[model samples]
Target: MGKQLGFYYNSNYCIGCQACETACKNKNKLPVGIHWRQVDHFETKNENNDRQVDRYISRSCMHCKQPACAAVCPVKAFRKRPEDGIVVQDREKCIGCRACVHACPYKAVAFSNQAVKASKCDLCIDELRQGEEPACVRGCPLQVLKAGDLREMEVKGVVKECQGFLKAATGPSIRFAPEKR
Candidate 1:
């Protein structure tokens, strides 16, 4: 699982409850309006059924193969770990320049108005080191999120991008379970 650890979200089954978001906040103790992960919901026409369906999206840092956040950070505060390909932020090095926030194509990086630093999902590296799944994966009531080797997950018929998510040049590390009819 060391080549590229990434996240897979099955949007078809997600209920948009923000349980993952809450769990992340609880685990990271993030201040108000600072989100390491976020949920977005919308209504779309189900082409198969010709009826409207609610679509819920849960996303965090893509931990991209070529992360723009890391590229744009003047302090080099963002880096992708060589062992697992998890993009990590060195907060101590951050200067709150917000370049990463603007450069990230996935919009994964977050700037805290309170702390004035940039932060994003690190995929709960401490938990991974202890052999536990990320807090968001553990916290989802519907069990829609999974994290592991990116290559292995790609073999499971996942798509590189979900609705409303663009395929950027950064090669986002996230995949999505195919939508169900």
Candidate 2:
């Protein structure tokens, strides 16, 4: 939409804390098993130095440039706003088909068992509409989650490529910057 919708996560600052996850759940009123955001851990060993290093990857909907969730949705519940490029779902229009769930490469989309409909982070649109940060970003203790323009944030070393195929498939708008040694 306004070139102002996106997120940047710096693993260096993330600390594997689940604060973001918890905040999203609380703000959305989601149950225990549902996670709008999840953290991934990557570990590597340096044989020469005899050291083990771990990297934390915090992931959620990238709200792609071309979201598969919107593409496969049968009822057109998922929509991508052209103004700021934000993807959102209309709860009233959803049919609980789960097609979007299968289409999402990052598995960022999920079907809510309680609601019997597909659900994912709407990037806290309600808060953003009021000029506030998403709940998860605001609640992150380490400030790992950030939302703003991708171009501007990238310059601050807070953005990076998408983790895998989702990067190529939808060109996810959000970026990540892992911690440095």
Model 2 clashing residue pairs (backbone)? 1-83, 1-84, 1-85, 2-83, 2-84, 160-176
Tens-digit lDDT track of model 2 for 62-176:
8888899999998999998877778888888988889999998878887877788888888888998999999989988888778987768767654456332236578787777
TM for candidate 1 is 0.95
TM-score of each: 0.95, 0.88
Identify the leading candidate in terms of lDDT. Answer: 1
Estimate candidate 1's RMSD in Å: 1.6
Model 1 accuracy (lDDT, Cα): 0.88
Q: Write the per-residue lDDT of candidate 1 for residues 82-122, one digit (tens) a residue.
A: 98898999999999999999998767788988788999999
Candidate 2 regions exceeding 4 Å error are 1-4, 46-49, 156-159, 162-166
